[model samples]
Target chain A: MDIAISLPIKDETLLPKLTIGDKIRVNGELFLFRDQVHKKIAENDTDQLDSINFLGSGVYYCAPTPVKEGFLIGSFGPTSSYRMDKYTEYVLKLGFKVMIGKGYRSDDIALLCKKYNAIYVITYGGCGALLNQYVKEVKLLAYQNLGTEAMQRVLVKDFPGYVAIDTFGNKLWK
Target chain B: MRQISCELFSNTLKSLLFETQYFIPEDVLENIKECYINESDSISRDVLNNILQNAKLSAATKLPLCQDTGIPQIFLELGSYVYLNFNLEKTVKNVVNIVYNEEKLRSSCVSDPLIRKNNLHCYSLHVDIVDNESLKVSVLIRGGGSENMSKTEMLLPGTTADEIKNFIVDNVINMLPYTCAPVIVGVGIGGTFEQSSLLAKKALLRNIGQRNQEKFYSMLEDMIKQNVNLKGCGALGLGGRVSVLDVFIETKPTHIATLPVSIVLQCHSVRKASKVI
Candidate 1:
């Protein structure tokens, strides 16, 4: 059976429907961050991230171009996720259920996703401009020193992606 | 001798850098169009559509084609007859700064690769001098996806062609969907260790679908493509015939006792542009 869903998903909603090989298209704001922003978040204890409700939320491993005069952001796309694997368990604990990025993940992270009933999606690696159009709105959140790797809240519409690893421990590609 | 102002050189560099961020080079665009029209799988087709649309939108809206706008790499062939009134290195730096600062392209360069600290706002530039009166520059916006997949090896003189092919094929299969497909493979052979790797990168700068001039190198290109495609890492590695868009090889003379090779993968978004002044 085929199922379609929207973004800002709840853990229960994702845990049941998505399986290996199932495609997912999310319509919600995607946050962009790379190594620097992730490192900062990993080192911090204040829980500043609590303000953002991640329950069933998706985070794209990306460092976007700075916003120009009229646009919300520039050339937004996914970066490799392996670099951020260390923080996955913690973020999942915070209620962020889905992660979007390119490349493979550690086995521990995959197991964690299965335990937490979360999913990891992979988008095309170099399709930044193509992916940016889906971003409806973008707000700069934090990590100013990081330049392109700064954290920003982004709203996306019909953001197309494929499930690389799903909640049930099925991997789409070996 | 003709005199060119520093400002002119700087501005020209700026334009090339900024324009290259969004615009797909003519050859790359054409090759992708061919792929889009010929691809059989619906999913792959849709992906191609997204890529094509992204290119159009990026060009029209002046947004970078990808977030990893890549380290700013410049290849220049400066003419001997032209006199530069300003420092070439400073001019290049100034242009890179303007593009990254004002244009808002991602700063891919970091202070330390191991430490992973972003070096404020900086980009990478490679300069070369050639015999010419007019400056010819090629600006390549290389994504990290492909850059990370690059590999280098030093083999004993007895390394067989079959072994070389297997090594490359093994790397490609292992990468699977990670490096993104269909990838453009660039192989550099016969140079010293570092030289081979640089030649591999330089090979990637060639226009997509352009064949190598040497007959043997051309055959090697064909051999690599067939071997890689047989692995079934298809388009996006989802399983299809178009695993690789093309394979390019560049070679140089090497030591009698050593054979070196470097494999550099270029993702589907093969971005590069050139300007002559």
Candidate 2:
């Protein structure tokens, strides 16, 4: 059978139809962050959050290296999603439909994904150099105090990621 | 006697930092290329291609190969014959600051683990002095993905070599895809707990694809590589032929009652550089 699907599937009705081997290519603006940025967000530091409007988009747990000249970012790869489990529900509440990272998530976040129509995606963990090319432009968001963990607004095109956790609570790994 | 100025240390360190960021070490690059050629899965092969292209662009453009330019770690072998010149810590800090600001590398380091504020951007540096006139420094730009997967355990004295191998193989299997498979495994055995962990990290500083000098250790490395690849972790843990590029083990004699082992994984982007001055 042949089929085509449009991504950023905000509607929950479409989640259950996804299968294990299904490949998804998401097109949306992304927000980049890591441990420090997540901590700041949990602490209610909205100063950096103001720079980005992630109301209905995705957030990538990443700490990218910088480029030499005429480049926006460097070796931007996914960090472990398990570390962000504590903040997943909160970010989902703030209106992010997609969470992209690597590794598995906690049960709490899995449950929240079911409650709220959101999907968690996983990318190759160490493929940073390849992943950076997907980022079209990067705008600093907040948490300059957090260095690489600071939040930034990033534009992506056909960003490749797999649905690790779906809205219906289906885990690709488990 | 050679009198080394603080300025000299800072300059050399900065150059090493920049060079490591720009050029992927020849051996590591070669291993990844080999994986690309041997990879059976189409998707994995394509992913490896993308990774190779990224390395090319990073090197030619003089950009950091991967973001997480890692903590500013320096393994220094200071020469005893050299006369004092300047403070080592300050020189390292200066080089770190220059790299952080000038190169725009992400400031991944923080002041405290608990408070977790990005007050400092330099990662921790480990220094050691040896009896020599020329200082040898090895810089490793470790990425978070593989570092996070490190594990340690204190085994009973009765634990056999088979047990050690099983422990390592199990951990590698469990961390597949998560730690970015096709990893380089470094094992530190027989030292104290902390010493074992440090030895494991130091093992990562070895040239990629090189074997340990001890015949038994070298044979162990070969066994580990074969077993891990058989796990089907493949490229990026998607399932393929080459799950691990290399495995290196370093061991030292410990108390008869203790057998400590530490495992540190290095992803395909094994970025490291060394210089003796």
Candidate 3:
């Protein structure tokens, strides 16, 4: 089943409507963070980090190439979800409601999602070019020195993906 | 001796980088289509369809096919009779920097492994002198997903054929979820530790589904392929009939004491290109 989802979803507002293997077209804000952003956040590098108020927001694990002449974003898509497994629990603990990436996540992520009533969305792994059109707007938020790993606030429209793990701990990948 | 211009090589490298990233090669595209036709699982088929659509879009748009344009490894076959006045590494670094900026590609390479600063030594380069009077360059763009999943093992000289096959099949299956399957497996067998790893990487140069000329190695490659596909890890490891697209194995004479084997994984986006001047 194909479902339409808006980001910054409230507590358990859309949990029952999502299930493993459900295709979703997402629209709304996706807070973008990749390798170093997660590292800095996990390290709690500053007091500023502690006050980030992205509660009930969608978080995407991706870092696209630089924007060329005229584009909202570069070739951007989900990175390998497993590599960010170590930082996932800590970030989720920061009150984010949705996680988006590609491939498998740790079993702990499934358990954590269940415990927190959160959802994990998996998109196409190596399809960044096709996925680039979803970015409606993008703004760099922090850590420009981190290069592509910098944090950004991204607005996406009709972003295509699937619910790989639901709030109930059901997983799409075996 | 024939003299070649430095700008010629630099221009070729720039175009190759763009060409490879934008267009999925004909052979690779054909192989994926074949796999899609044979795929029975609905989810796996959908993934394959997306891959095709992505390739079409990448070429049409001329943006990069994947966000990770990948670490470019340039291999040069310099003709022994050809004369070149430039230093290879410095030239590559200079040209790659300019080309990267022009294309607005990501700066992936770092200066020091520990310090983590961006540096000039971005591409891995290997040059060999050949008899022909032609300079040929081949570039392979390896993304993080498949490259990280690559493995190496030093088996005893006494290890049986079945053991080698099992070693490769098992590891690939286990790493499927992370590698972005279905992947093309490259195996380097029977060289010194370093040479074996090189051979494995070079094996990716083979056209997809092209078997080794020797019957024994060719059969071994087929065996590994069959075993992996039978496991049904499928596209993106989402459970399907095709986990591996193909397997290519390269071999060299090795020391009697040690048998080195290295497996390099190439994801669905098998980006490689070559040009001669």
Candidate 4:
């Protein structure tokens, strides 16, 4: 079904409503993290990560261009999700129900999502300028030293995406 | 000898970087539109439409086309008779730092791969000295997604074009969705291991929708392009008829025992800008 749904961070009810191929409009807060942030969160002390209170939230695999003046944020979009597959179980276990990224997810990650009652969504790859319209605000949360790969908390309105993997293991790319 | 000031050069680089990141070249844009018209699959067509809209929005807003602003790559065709007032390498890096910060482009470079320390000021510059008196610089914003999918292979001297075709097909399939199709497949054949890869990247700098000057290589490009699209990798690799927008091949004579081939895949954005000064 071609339906648009709103998904807020720290919400669990939206996952069940999403199925493969359904267009989603994520309206709420999203935590932005990429390669370095993921590795840090998975390997380092969890204190910094725990402080964010991202449990039951959506984690967006992305990095933004520098935030320009008078704008909430810079052009922002999803990075490839497969690179984050190794760390999926860790974040999913942390109660992240919504994983937004781009490209296909590995079978293991899909299985993990099924086990954890989480879902994987895809934003159009390389559509950063268009996606930036949804960003309402941006805040640097932690790891400022990572520069671009640092963790960021962003508030988004009507953020467009598509469900690539459902909790039931149905994958749109497959 | 012609003298160029560092300030002029830096300003030019900055402009090129900003313009390329925000705007898709006209030829490339036109080719994508053509792909959109010819695409039959609904999903692929929708994906192409999104790409088109993304280009429009990027140009309209003066924002980056993708969040992966990419590592800035500058290819300099420096003339032997031309002289720069300052150290070229350091000058380019310094200019990149100012431009990236001033333009709010993302920093994707790291101080060390293992430690993963970010270097916001880093840029890669490749310098080639030519006989002419003009300096030409070509800039490409290579996203991590497609850049990571580049492949190089060394085959026996007798490796056939069919084998090369299979190799290209296999890599595209393996990199599906991840590499971001309708990709431009740049293939380099018959140089030393490293040169082959360099040629592959150089091939990407060529104008889109244009074939190699040599008829033999052009035919090979067409053959590979046809075979790849037949794989149904489609737009964004979501599945469709057009997996590739174009295929480019660059070649050089190699030693008798080596048939080195390198492939560099460029996503649909294909952000490139060049200037001859």
lDDT (CA) for every model shown?
0.76, 0.75, 0.85, 0.83
The two-chain DockQ for each candidate, comma-separated, is 0.64, 0.49, 0.71, 0.71
Worst 10 residues of 4 chain B by lDDT: B115-124
Residue range B62-163, candidate 1, lDDT tens digits: 788888777766777777887888888877877787778888777677777687767655555665666767887777667777778888889888998788
Model 3: runs farther than 4 Å from truth? A11-13, A49-52, B118-121
- Sort every candidate by lDDT, greatest first: 3, 4, 1, 2
Q: Report the lDDT tens digits of candidate 4 across residue range A9-52.
A: 44566577678777777877888987777776678556777656
Q: Score candidate 3 by TM-score against the native.
A: 0.96
Per-residue accuracy of model 2 over B1-277 as CA lDDT, tens digit each = 7777776777778888888776878888888898898887755676677678878877776566666677756788778787657777777887888887897777676677787666566655786777877878788777666778899999998997887888998888787767666678889998788889889988988877688998888988888878888877676666677778888899988888999999998877777888887
lDDT of 4 by residue, B122-224 (tens): 6778888999999998998898898898989899988787888888778777776786678888899988999998899889988876899999889989988
TM-score of chain A of each: 0.88, 0.86, 0.94, 0.92
* Ten-residue stretch with the least lDDT total in model 1 chain B: B119-128
Task: Please give the range of 10 consecutive residues that has the lowest summed lDDT in model 1 chain A.
Answer: A1-10
Error of 3 at B274 (Å): 0.8
Off by over 4 Å in 2: A1-18, A36-56, A65-69, A106-117, A141-147, A166-174, B5-7, B129-131
Candidate 1 stretches with Cα past 4 Å from truth are: A1-3, A11-13, A44-46, A50-52, B1-8, B79-83, B112-121, B127-129
Instruction: Give the TM-scores of the predictions, in the order they appear.
Output: 0.91, 0.88, 0.96, 0.94
